[model samples]
Target: MIKVVKRKGKYLVRQGHTRFHGLKLAISEGANIPKLSVILIDYKNEIEEYLENLDGNRSNGLNPVGQAHALAHAVSLGYSVEELAMRYQRSTTAIRNMLKILDMPLELQRLISLNLIKKTLAIEIMLKYSNDHKMVLKHIEGFLPGVKNIETTTSKIVGIPEHNAAGAGPDTLNKGGPEKKNSAVTRKTLGIKRLSHKKTERLKSEFLELVESTHTESITNTQTELKFGRDSAHLFKNVNSNNVIFSNDGVQIILNDEKLNILLSLLNDENTAIIVSKPKLEELLEIRDLLKEY
Candidate 1:
């Protein structure tokens, strides 16, 4: 039933907008809305309470911008975090995040209202570049190539150039290939001791072995499951969670089957998150030394 307040011979709808719109559509289609029901209200007394409750009872299915506006209105009406959270059926943290959406740059708000960008991405831009709406738009244009006139930042891709990625052409490599003659010279110029080829190879091999031994899914934002392997049990043990997985927390490499990509997950936040202390600190230093030398 539609609830409305009658004032000066006109009605102001306070709820059931969907039903009212449906009645309009039905009327336009030459169909009967004979069973329409509405509750009358005393405009002077109930309107304020009705409006307040309306803002607080916003449906979660509303658009992100609508949700933000409704939540913001609730906050402005002296609604506490706990009250808003309960009314919105969300956590207090989620309510805070919703309110934060209004504080984002105006350009971001527009994009969100138009559904061009997501709420989370908008918040990320807001956090990164407070009010730099130009930069935020430029960054957003990168992920959405179809959006025209955004003047994307066009950052240079940091990898092998397409022409050199694979080359059988003449300019690719001269007869002796690139020279390592200057490699040892450059090391000497930096006052660093250069290892012999045999020693370097041995060190590299050992470094790889150590990396494999220390490989674990205990690293942050990374987890692995044994899809199918004969030695899956041992693999799982090496990669499983442990309060003290290593003597020192560092970057751990996680290999995934998707595109055979190797992911480097930082395990650096040791003091509070991951318990990282043991008698095997020397091995970790050995890994560090090999990394430094290489």
Candidate 2:
């Protein structure tokens, strides 16, 4: 029986001193020799489970599955796939795709496990250019954080930036004002405005539908009230209510005494308009008319 024992930060057999001494001498001469551990596990079932776990399931002993799993695991643990694959004799493409699973934000991975995203699509996204991949991942993370399968996630990610995806000139697409004017002129010359209004209306309908489809709870609301009351005087009072009072502005004001004072100070400013409910469409149209007049 080989007696396994620990000595000088290494595991060695007591009967194999000659071999151990040779290894120690090699280490002393600056050769890199790995330290070893000798564990005497008593549970047969536990040992079998461990053996099964370590088994690569390779028929021809190439162990591609084991290598792939190892590459994936190493990437998840923060080891760069390029470095590990270089050392382990695996293709960089395989390593990279494996690492992409690790690159998925934790929240997205949970969705993926739940079948929200397809595996093929996720792998495709992982293989995209770094910047494009990151942008797609960010959009997905924001909108469909709990998405599980690949198809849905891919569709959502691609759709978010579809406008930018058109190989149209970047300046024409992104730059506003004068550049947009030039582009419009060019479009008119090329007779590209054939379905312009129809396209605009379609986009408008799509935007409205998208907004309507979203959960209302995701939207936030803020209310502001303006009172036209005199100093220390109760403005408008409701007939049926005692504590609840109305303001002369035809709205209920629910401000503390201090806030009321600040609001009064702002009300006195000539340049300010008390905008209510995001400025009505009529008000916007009037502004446009005034601009046209100018």
Candidate 3:
């Protein structure tokens, strides 16, 4: 798909590959060439250009995991939350929330991909427990041990303070005696308040049990499978996790961690060092000698 922007009197390509060979082939063969559709995009600046690029390709199998990587890369490359929000067609709050989700474990990513867990619920759990995986897992499994109270969990997401006027007096109020305590109690008990602890725990326990029993094993297995695949690829094919390239001679060059460490070690040593074989050492010394002469 080609995207174009107006420049002067003509439409100029803003994104997409300009493959001329296919058109040439069609023209030469006198085939009835199909008309290609072009999309016109309007961008105020470079930020918009980056957004357009992300959005245009995003719909093509860009799952939550893929989006996490892409968005993280954009962030590392200095795109601010506002710019990312505008580009991704999301609110700034959503962008921030999504960025937080990037730190999710592989198992959670698997669950997200399978649509087994709702993004909102995951975010709530993460926020409530400060992204402690153990707490998140235990809470999901219907075991709210220790301080993992439903009241605290709901309060954070629902925008209610843990200890309000009735529980803990407002900061501006002076420390006082029974009169202030009575007023606070009266205010708390007067109207409809949070559910009783028993009812809340019962409902939460049921909900968590249902969610965990349904999804946990599958997601955990998926995480294990993903890890195995990556490790196997590196071991058998010499295809590292990142920065792998195939040269024209059909050789794969991977600037992976092991290779990088070796290279750095060789560079740090002033004298010729043994690396791989004697010829390799001679080649390095030759390069060093050439650099010295220059």
Candidate 4:
């Protein structure tokens, strides 16, 4: 499809330049192509035009980094997530998911762009690990598909006999009961006890570090608070008790229709000293007027 823009009193090709050129080449060779499709779009400014141009170019899809960049650029151009969703023909949730990619560490982004980490895997890392760059990277490093397969195959290759090679049956290997016997058998067959205690302690330490790092680094960044978790739990405790919180996005309240009507009824009382920001007040006033219309 060709998107044309009005320029110099003529409809000019704004998108699908390659397709246009291909058609032109076909025409030059006397190939009969009677059908053509075109779409005309109007934009008030160059930024809008450029944004559409960028959208047109993304029909083939983008890598995770490019997706994040595009979403970020659209936001920088004063587009809301809802607006971007409409423009891109996507759900607001999808647009928000793309925006989340921007909050990831640069190293993770590089890995994603390089395709060393799949986008689905990266998203899994983000959701499971949150904002811990080191832990995410470490997990990626230790994700050995081939080695895991080999280990499983090797275990099957070394078949288990009625008695172990050391002449120890399940009953003889563990006197601690069935669970213990199973555990003992697994340990003996896998030779897990051969790993040094020092190495085990080191692994435990690294795991604790990963957990601590995830906690510390995650809390300091307000992105999660802005996204999934509401910010300042202690500070907003009182506000939450009222079942509502005012934010830059506007007021979000947990109220039934009856409760909302009761609150609206209270709005007309002379003693109610409601304090709200200008934008919020405007929204409330609009709502009040809208209620009158109903």
Candidate 5:
């Protein structure tokens, strides 16, 4: 049935657009048409309900980009995304992705028309090429033919300018302008100070004493017969600093140097404890569980 809405005696197509076109063609060819079936809807109110069927039926012959343009048009006509999705029988995310196609450069939109790129690939290229359709086309023309996967090919685009990296390009990067006063990052900006060699050695000695006084007794006495979990294959233990010790069963971990000056400043405080490694904590937890069970 060719669905339509009569507005001021002028019938507007509401559904079955393909059927209506075919019916017109049949009439033009002198074919005898006795009965015509059509459903006339209220033009003022039912506009949103059946908008997808107005242009040759969205589910049948309309390409994705075409549908995206239609969706964009619907959005411009004061229809909400949710309303469009429901009327078009599409998920909200899918509808949004489709609508995104309309904003893309025409070349990328043409790829969508050619069925070479769908929503996912279009988005990937949008981010990867900084939405530069010329770069996208160059990549596709130069590399996409011999390659089977477009994403893997595009990801490996080498010798490309740093401008193409995600969210980091153009005005954000070095633009050959005068550098700002605080442009260079330093430890002072990161809440850590640049310590002199002698001061650093002094802090390390004090931290070694602190670790020894805090953990020597318990760590030396810890011996577990039952090991429920596998030991981590790689531990980030720096063995060079004898003055900064964090040893667990012969594995020594180094504390971050940024906190050294702060820790040395508060060495005499009684309530501050520095818990370091996962193995030590897990052993303590297992001991607690065993105590509860007993």
Candidate 6:
């Protein structure tokens, strides 16, 4: 005979229904309905409290365990998957994937729990190295222990530019190249033991003399009264022969040491110049003499 019993909101079969029915038909026997106890437990509240406690204990409070428990609670609390995802700053797909990690190995789960691996890297490892998970774990164990010295390691791995390695650029390279070659040639030609200060001064003097002799005629013409302004009788101002006048065409004579030094400095720099004021022609001539001595 079959008998049906209801206990704690669940049904249980105690005996065969057919046999119970036959026995009741033959004897007119009455069947007893067992008392059912409804013991109410706040399961939802208990689950929520457990999840919240787990979340508080997790590294970054965003690990898989905490996330799964929270998500499950959210679902039980009548939140849609999309709504739960939005609340947790994740995509629905990511939430689903997090749920999937619940089936991964315990070591990997512990790695996630301890924050040894970030979520993104952990996801990458799982996707690429799942077949060789042991090897991947070994790599992480061996390599990821210390702080990385990125700058030094990168410099060593990738070399610096040859010229820039010594803190020089194109301008320095260009200027230094000729002088470097010339110094070697000069030492060979003159049989100099070393480049002494006296010898350097002498070479500079000779170079200056050569420059002056080459421009002698031009300097002489600068002394004459040249035309200034419109067609006139006496607008011919005397060229400041002592002052050095540097123009796009050639040098003009003014003759001050300071002004000559300024012009030479500008010329050495290969920079453009602007005329501030007119200079004395006599002072500039004296500078020409001084420059010749270097």
Q: Which candidate number would show the highest lDDT if scored against the true structure?
A: 4
Ranking of all candidate structures by their lDDT, best first: 4, 5, 1, 3, 6, 2
lDDT of 2 by residue, 89-116 (tens): 7656555544455455443443334334
lDDT of 6 by residue, 113-212 (tens): 4444454455545444543667655545454432122122222111111222211111111111111111111223323255688986787677556445
RMSD values, in order shown: 24.4, 22.0, 27.4, 24.5, 22.7, 33.0
Model 1: per-residue lDDT, tens digit, 76-165? 656677977786587676776677776765545544544555676565455555446677556655554423332212221111111111
User: Candidate 2's error at 177, in angstroms?
Assistant: 49
Candidate 5 residues lying further than 4 Å off, grouped into runs, are 17-35, 45-52, 55-60, 144-294
Cα-based RMSD of candidate 2: 22.0
Instruction: State the lDDT at 53 in candidate 5.
Output: 39
lDDT of each candidate versus the true structure: 0.48, 0.40, 0.47, 0.52, 0.50, 0.42
> Which regions of candidate 6 are displaced past 4 Å?
1-64, 72-80, 86-89, 131-135, 142-294
Q: Any idea what lDDT model 2 has?
A: 0.40
Model 4 is weakest, by summed lDDT over 10 consecutive residues, at 168-177
Instruction: Give candidate 1 regions above 4 Å deviation.
Output: 8-10, 21-36, 41-61, 129-138, 141-294
Candidate order (TM-score): 5, 4, 1, 3, 6, 2
**Backbone clash pairs in model 4 (N, Cα, C under 3 Å; residues 3+ apart or in different chains), count:** 0
Tell me the lDDT of model 3 at 21: 43
TM-score of each: 0.39, 0.23, 0.36, 0.41, 0.42, 0.25
lDDT of 1 at 230: 38
lDDT of 5 at 285: 38
